[model samples]
Target: MSIWGKFAGAVVGAYFGGPLGAVAGTVAGHYAFDRELDKEVAFTIALIALSAKMAKADGIVSPVEVDAFYRICRVPEGEQRNVARVYKLAQEDIAGFEAYARQVAEIFADRPKVCEDVLDALFYIAYADGTLNHAEEVFLRRVAENFALSEADFSRIHARHNPNVFDPFAVLGIDPNASFDAARSAWLKASRENHPDQLQARGVPVEILHLANDRMAIINSAWEMIRKEQFNKDV
Candidate 1:
C-alpha cells in the first residue's frame, strides 16, 4: 500500500518518539497501532515536517508553495486532510527545524543520498514561489548542515533549483577542467544513484518518486548540454 493508505488506515504507528512522532500521533489521533513505523511512513512524515518548517522559514506559506508540495508529495484526495494536519501541526509546534532535521539525519544516517533527496525536495518548494529568498536560503543551508551534507553537496543540489544560475558542471558536481571521460563518468554515477528504484530502495515513498524523475531529467539535461558543448569545442 502507498504511504497515504498507511496513514488513512485506522492504525498508525511511528517508532521514533520526539517531534516527528508527536506530530504523527496527533495526526493519527486515537488510532494507535503497536508496531515500528515502516521506513517509508517515517520518510513521508519527515518530509511533511521538514517542508512545513521550511515554509515558515520565510514567515509565510504561500499557496504556490503549498501547491508545489502537494505536487511533489502527490497527497491523495482522501488523505489530503490527514497529510495537511501533519504539515499544520509541525508548523505550529514550537520545536525548531534543527530538531526535526537532526531526527531525520539520524533516521537516515546510513543513507546520505536520501538526505540529499530531502534537501532537493525542499529546494523544489522554495523555488515554487518564483524566487529563493534570503530567509529560505539561510534555512536551507542550516538544514543542509544539520543533515551532515558538505558544502559541495549543497551547492550541487542548489544549482539544480537556482533559477538565476545554470552551471551544468555544478549540477553534475564536476570541475570544469575535468576530462570528458571524467564528466561522462560523473553523469553515469549520478544517474545510477538518483534513479527512482535506488530512491525507493532507500525508503523514499513511491509517491515522492516523481521528485526523482524530475531530478533525473535535470541531471540528464546537464550531461547533454555538457556533451554538446564539448563536441562543439572539439570541432
Candidate 2:
C-alpha cells in the first residue's frame, strides 16, 4: 500500500476508539503490500538462483558472472543494498529452483508456445550481456532438454539468443575420422575458440574465462573419447 493509503486506513481505524484497531489496520495494510512484494521478490530470487547455478556449472563461480547478473537484471542499488537479503534469497531460490522449474513446466503445460516464451526469457537471462559461460549454456540447454522441448523449439530459442561459439566438430572443421590428426585438429580448433583470452576479448571477463577453459577441457575430452572409439574399431 502507498504511505497515504496505509495512513488513511490507520486513521479510520483510530477513529473507532481503540489504538489496537489502528495497529491492526496498519498491519493488515502492510501484509497486503508485502504479499505483492513477496511475489516480485520470489520471481527475482528464482532467476538469480538459476543464474548462480548456471555460473557454477563450469565448476567455479566468478565475480564476472555475478556482475553479469546484476547488469542483466538491472537490480537497483537500493534493493541490492540489502546484500544479506539478496544472498539469503539466492540460497533459498537455488534450493527451490527445481521446484520452480517444475512449476513453470506445469504452468506452461499444454502450451508449447508459451513454454517457448519462457525458454526465451531464460535464454535472455542466461546470455545477457553478450556471452553465456559454458556452465550457463549447459544449464540452459539442460533446462530445455528437461522439458523435452522439440529440437526445432530448442534451435529457435538458441539461435535467437545464444552464441554460435565453440562447436566442437565445427572447431576442428573435420568429420570424426580414423586419423589422429583429425582429432587433434578438432581439439586445436575448439581450444582456440575457447581460449581464455578470446573469452575476455568477447566480454567474458577474466574471472569467468575459467568456464571457457573448462569447456576447452570438455572438447579435448570428447575428442579423446571419439579417438578411443575409432581406435578400438580399427583394432
Error of 2 at 211 (Å): 25
Top candidate (lDDT):
1
lDDT of 1 by residue, 10-71 (tens): 22544357678778887656535434667787788888999999988878888898899999
- The most accurate candidate by TM-score is 1
- Clashes in predicted model 2: 1
lDDT of 2 by residue, 83-110 (tens): 2243334443434344445544543354
Give the C-alpha miss distance for residue 126 in model 1, angstroms.
0.3
- Global local distance difference test of model 1: 0.86
The true-versus-predicted C-alpha distance at residue 42 of model 1, in Å, is: 1.0
Give lDDT: candidate 2, residue 164.
56
lDDT of 2 at 95: 44
The per-model lDDT (C-alpha) reads 0.86, 0.47
Off by over 4 Å in 1: 9-11, 29-35, 231-235
